[model samples]
Target: MTRRAVFAGWWVVAGAFLCMLTGYAVAYSFAAFFGALESEFGARRGEISLVFSISAFLYFLLGFPAGLIADRTGPRPVVVGGLLLIALGLVAAAQADTLWQVYAGYGLGVGLGIGFSYVPSVAAVQRWFVRRRGTASGIAVAGIGVGTLVGAPVAHWLIAAIGWRHTYLVLAAVAVAGALLSGWLVRPGPERYGLTPDGDPPLPSGASTMPAGLGLGEAVRSGPFWSIYAGALLMSFGLFVPFVHLAPYASDVGLGEGFGVLLIVLLGVGSTVGRFLFASVTGWIGRRLSFALMYVGAAAMLVLWSQSTSAPALVAFALLFGAFYGGFVAIAPSLAADYFGGRALGSVIGALYSGVAFGALLGSPVAGYAYDFFQSYTGAILAGAALCLVSFAITLAMPEPARWLAARRPGP
Candidate 1:
């Protein structure tokens, strides 16, 4: 067979992975820069944390529009545009001398850039696969973990050597290179290539193909969508709190700066493994059960994280939390596609991811404020654990989407 005949969808997966790796490397690497920004600006934790919170909010807030654009046009342009914005955001952030500048540059620019790239890439990947949707999505998102693993330590080293400003400049260059490379590779689904989703042959007589799911409005009005959204929002609340605070918290507990960054590395390791493992298993265990498992695991880990005071304990918390956290990230889009169908998958997934925006907006800064007020992370940790538990309950209570339920019933 010719090279193109071997299922070109995997090429889309590769492009999506590269885009995520580059974009998230810049996005998540903010944790490494968190302390430096605080020191440089003489800002409060809440203030520094707001940079990430704003970026995250815009990233998710814009997902709906980005996805709509992707649905109407295609993913390549969206991905390319996002990469340019990300580069510009980093460059502008590098030049910032004021908090408002940071907000505009990093928060608004980078946030919108990431938002533009994320949903489209994910939704595009969903459209390219059917039976293997879970595994394909998992593999694509594993880039986030890999990016974190590489980006966190590199950011730390660069900051120590050259300072955060230059580091941002360096990341900006990387973003440009990533965009140029991956943009060439990202295309729409199989139809563009004269194939079907998953590259499967035409179905035999009487075999049922899945229907296109609800329209954007119908999806919004559905109970299952909201259930997923609520669960995702709560889960994100628990997830990002530690992500932003873990570095600083390590320093507070006397683990030293090196250990603080090490925590991020460990989290990345666990996250990468979890995304691949948990999502791959969905073919066997199913999406709902897999999601519930991740929620419960994350909640349990957060409890452990709350009590952690030592290096080993924190390390354990990082691994467990990262695993479940990564699993949830990998599974969310797939779950949305499973319920909503691929017709309007971009818009549906984008709207659902807005939950992430709300969660991050509420979680990180509030945790920072709690720390500032009480001079302790105890309350923040407990709050995160509570959010995780709430998410767990919500996930359990979620019913199958109406489409899926209807599909399972016997036809006359």
Candidate 2:
């Protein structure tokens, strides 16, 4: 019997997966801690919601610099530094006696930590594959979905049993371990392994060592860049609302207490499936079309959430919205790589995500404010759906990747 040789690239993917799983496990687990933070601080919904938004804003905003640094210095050190910040943040937050202290620790610490690690790790995975770029990327980022799946419920249980402060200490330990392991696994590219991407045969010694593609400056100047950027910005305005609000939304509609974990679990489960399935099928459907569908489908599902008052209906909304949201996230970096190419891919991906970062900063807070003012989430949910529809239209106007690649300016 012959054994197939394992591709080393998958190890990189595994590293990325672990890094994201650990990082997002911290980020997404806030839902479980939401009630605790609010009750402890005596904060309102809008005030409590800012904690997640502030963190998301920093991470996304910082991802570009982290990518550039990783591109120059390698992903290992960047990820390590980032994870350390996350650990420190978790530890600091655990000790905080006031809301502002928690913000400084969790919001600033975790946000910047994820910024430094997440983009560079995921972008690193793209550099290691060509033929399987979409699927590989999907698998790598699926850690986010899996993290959301496991992190929320576990955090909830831990918070119930041991308390939120102790659970944070446990998370801090996990962040440190993630730092060490991910730093070891995430190399810059496939070149050093004596093989090309996808484990293809080695290039001749005389072949150009430089990867093919555009620089960060060149990529942001293109037509596709703005279209994609605008779409990302618009889509993100609604993007995080669900992750932050689904638990409370379910309760508002009379699903009862303790249902938060179930809704969050459903979201995680659907996202994990969506990442795998959407990414796996991109070869047949094309990444661009699938991405557009993600926008449309998410928008439609958000509308469902506005109308849902029953358990099954809310369940459907959580699963279906999660699937589309997961697909949108999983496809993004791969699609950008397709449009821009591999050269300075990390920086390019980072630049694109700035839109996402800024939009995420606004999403949940806006929903929180809307709910406070109107006393119903229906307005914010429908507004979120509207933003997604606009993003879908922008995506529809963009060219297919192959055509864009064929027309891209040469010699970056």
Each model's lDDT comes to: 0.86, 0.88
Question: Total clashing residue pairs per candidate?
Answer: 0, 0
Please write out the lDDT profile of model 1 over residues 155-252, one tens digit for every residue.
99999999999999999999999999778878897766556778776456423244576789988887778988888887777678777889999999
User: Quick one: best TM-score, which candidate?
Assistant: 2
TM-score of each: 0.95, 0.96
Candidate 1: residue 146 Cα off by (Å): 0.8
Q: Give the C-alpha lDDT of model 1.
A: 0.86
Q: List model 2 lDDT by residue over 200-318, tens digit each.
A: 76667634233588888888889988888889898888889988888877777777546866888888888989998899778888988889999999999999988988989888988
Candidate 2 to truth, TM? 0.96
Candidate 1 regions off by >4 Å?
1-4, 202-210, 401-403, 407-412
Give the range where candidate 2 is weakest over 10 consecutive residues by summed lDDT.
202-211
Local lDDT at 172 for model 1: 94
For residue 136, what is the lDDT in candidate 2? 91
